[model samples]
Target: MYIHFIAIGGSAMHNLALALHNKDYKITGSDDAVYEPSRTRLLQKGLLPKEMGWFPEKITANLDAVILGMHAREDNPELQKATELNIPVYSYPEFLYEQSKEKTRVVIGGSHGKTTITSMVLHVLKYHQKEVDYMVGAQLEGFDTMVHLTKENDFIVLEGDEYLSSPIDRRPKFHLYKPNIALLSGIAWDHINVFPTYENYVDQFRIFIDSIVKGGILVYNEEDLQLKKLVSETTNTIRKHPYQTPEFRVEDEKTLLQTPEGDMPVSVFGSHNLQNLAGAKWICQHMGIDEEDFYEAISSFKGASKRLERIAETSKAIVFKDFAHSPSKVMATTKAVKHQYPKKQIVACLELHTYSSLNAEFLREYQGALNAADTAVVYFSPEAIQNKKLAPVAEEQIFNAFDRKDLQVYTNPEDFQKLLEQQHYEDVVLLLMSSGTYGGLDFNKIAEWIK
Candidate 1:
């Protein structure tokens, strides 16, 4: 089979390209620009376009299908050409559904815990030597590509994102998966630019629930009232399974899970992660994995990349970086770290990078989100706002929106780095939370300074 990608430089797109290439399918892709890891990986697989930018000439009748990335606009040249030729076109999520239509599809969805839950399931399955096709949001340990596909795999585990499937496909990505088994960790309003209101944002999850295949199972976080309401209202022909934070305790800075075999020590911690583990456990159970076997495998799971990932550590201090820009994610991450290291002084810094996070209306949702930290800092670049064509936000507005009078805000990366460097590292933990690089600040350099 031959497949062509329009805007293949995306994290997920490039991974999918490589996965298909590894499966012995002919893969070709074009993008105006390609960045680091994706570009490097594509070149390594000999899938990188000889030249960047869309080429309508590349779209031919012989191609089996054209997979579109979210980065590509509806009017993208290659996309227009594909439409002209009447060649089969698919949004990434749509194509995933097509590939796994005959297999048991397990989709992990939620506002915050999707990546962690997906990673946990993948880790447990790998531990048991279960062969499965998968697409996870984050790069995980022991996984060469974030996406993997093979003819032998009878199941596909997908990290279901609530965001749009493609520029032309306005529907949420998760709606296309039609999972035989699904998990929703929690619901928190996000993507202000698209959904606008919290109620509208939540409606997407409800749609996802209605889209599940008949007789499927839904594993959801019962602690979230929104999720509870959605699940209660759903009349779909699917079994509902509710999960909450499991029995766990922190001992000497280690999180131990209470299992039938006794307290099994795990590398991951926090109420959010524990809830994620519970959700993943239920999904694994549905996949024919027993609780004991699941716990035994999960005990060694560290975490998903950039979801409270430990970047650097010393005996005196530790530094963590998390891809947490949304209000709920920021709150959970900050609270989790503080709870995990109660004795340490916590310095939590977050960057307002995404369009939703920078929107004036959405800023109010972040009220007191960082209050758990001993010291809280928020960063935003005026240049970023301009680049995204968003209305400029003042530091005062951000500070007031957070409702934290003690919060420190920065518009400069150098000053932010200097402020961090001045802090004494002894008995302290630094958490940097952002979806984008903090104005291109070098995390390794900052780690070295703190060390």
Candidate 2:
């Protein structure tokens, strides 16, 4: 098949392109601008666009399909050209679904922990030498590319995101999956830009629950009251299973899971992670992995990229970098680190880079999120707010929102960097949480600080 990608520089889009290219398909892509990693990866695969930006003249009717990325605007010349030529155009999720339509789709969905849960499922399956098609949000340790597709695999594990599928298609991406087997980690309000109200954001999950294939299985977190309520109220035809945080103990900063056989130590820690692990276990069992094999494989699962990933660690101190910007994520991450090392001085730093976090009204959702940290710091760039066209958020608003009088806020990245540099590493847990880099702070330098 011959395929052309619109906005192929996207993380998911580029991965799909590479997956297709490996399958002996002729793949060509275009993007206005491509950033690091994506740009280099595309180049390595010999799939890089010869020239950046769209070329409407290249959109011929002979092309089999055009996969659209959400970053591409509806008015993009390439997209318009493809439409005019009557070539089929599929959104990223739409294409993924089309390929896996015949296979059992196992989609992991939630506000947070979905990536980690999906990664865990993939990790367990790979360890057992069980090959299956998969799409995960973050890069895993064993996976060369984050996406894999094959006609032989009977099942496909997907990290189903609730964000918009594409610029032109406003439906949440997860809604398009229609999974035969689905897992909802838990729902929390997010994407304030798209779903303006918290209630509206919650309704997306409702739609997602309804979209599950009839007679399919839905594994969810029972501990989450809101999620439990949703499951109870749902009239979907799928069989429902609820999981809770499993028994575990933190021993010498190591998380030991209490299994039916015995205490098994796992590389990943945190209450939320434990909950995610339980959900993954249920999903894995449904996929034909036995309990013994699931436990054996999951013991070696470290975690997903940038989700409580340990960057630097020593006997005295440890530093972790996490992709946590939303209120629930920030709160969970901060508490997880603190719970892991009760003796250490917990210093948590978060960057408000997302449109929701920068909004003054949404800031209130972060109330008491950083309470677990001995010292809490929040950083935001005024330029980002201006670019997002959001209202200005003052330092006072941040302090008030978090309900922390002594909370330190930084609008300048240099000041945050300096503060991190001067930090004493001894008996401390430095947790840096952000989806965006703190003005491109060099993590290598911070890793070197573990003395």
Candidate 3:
């Protein structure tokens, strides 16, 4: 089938384009701008648009469908033309659903841990020689692409995001899947710009739960009180399976799982990940994987990229980078590093990068989020705040928000780097938490300098 992608340079959109290309479907895509990795990958596949930006002339009726990305605005010329020509336009999630309608869809959703849980399930399934169409948000160790779709797979694993589907489609992406099986890792208020209130944000998850097929299964994280309450209150006919953090011990900086066979060593650590593992186990079991096989395969899983990933290590120092920006995620990631290396000094540095993180009102929600770190530093750029059209966030506001008298704050990237360079590296765990680069700092160079 022939498909044209509108604003296809998006991380998820590019992956889907590559997946369709690999599936022998005729794929063409156009974007106003394409950045690294997406640009390189698209060029490699010869799927890169000959010219950038949308063109109304490209929206021909002969195209089977036009896949829309969130990057495209509502008034995009191509999208307008597609509508004028009466050609079908599908949001990326909608297109994915169309492709997997015949397959058993397993969707993992939450405010966080969705990517990790989905990656774990995919890793275990791949290890067992199971064939499945899948889409994960992050780049995993062995996966060629973040998305893989095929005609022969009987099942599909989707990393369900709770964010809006597209500019034209106001529904959450997860709600479009209508999964046969679903998992909720946990919930924390996010996307404050979109949802505005905690209750409004939670209503999205409720809608997602309601979208599950009749008699389908929902595996959830019982440790999350809010999520637990939601699942308990749901009267849907779907089966409910709840899980918590599994029994595990940290030994010599490594986390080991207590199993009947023996103590198995796992590459990923922390209570959040352990909780994610338990949820993945339930999904895998429902997919026909035995408990023993799940345990064995998970023991070898090295974690999804940038979710508590160890970027550099030495005899006396270890540096970790994570995509943690929300208050709950910041707290969990900080606690995880501290718990694993109790004897070492913890220096947790976080960048206020997201729209939610930069908001003064939202700042109050981060109270005590970084308490676990021995030394905590928060950094934000005034330039970024202005660029996003957000109110200026004072360093004093951040200092008070964390409720840690000792918290250090920086509005200048240079000062942040200098402070980082001056820190003592002896027996220390350096945790860098952000959804963005801390103002374009080269992590590898910094790691080498620290070493």
Residue clash pairs of candidate 2: none
Model 2 spans > 4 angstroms off: none
lDDT of 3 by residue, 97-193 (tens): 9999999999999999999999999999999999999999999998999999999889999999998889999899999999999999888999998
For 111-151, candidate 2 gives per-residue lDDT tens digits of 99999999999999999999999999999998999999998
Candidate 3 residue 67 C-alpha distance from true site, Å: 1.1
What residue pairs clash in candidate 1, if any at all? Answer: none
Off by over 4 Å in 3: none
Against the unseen true structure, what C-alpha lDDT does each candidate score? 0.92, 0.93, 0.93
Q: What's model 2's overall lDDT?
A: 0.93
- How far off is residue 99 in model 1, in Å? 0.7
| Worst 10-residue lDDT window, candidate 2 | 442-451
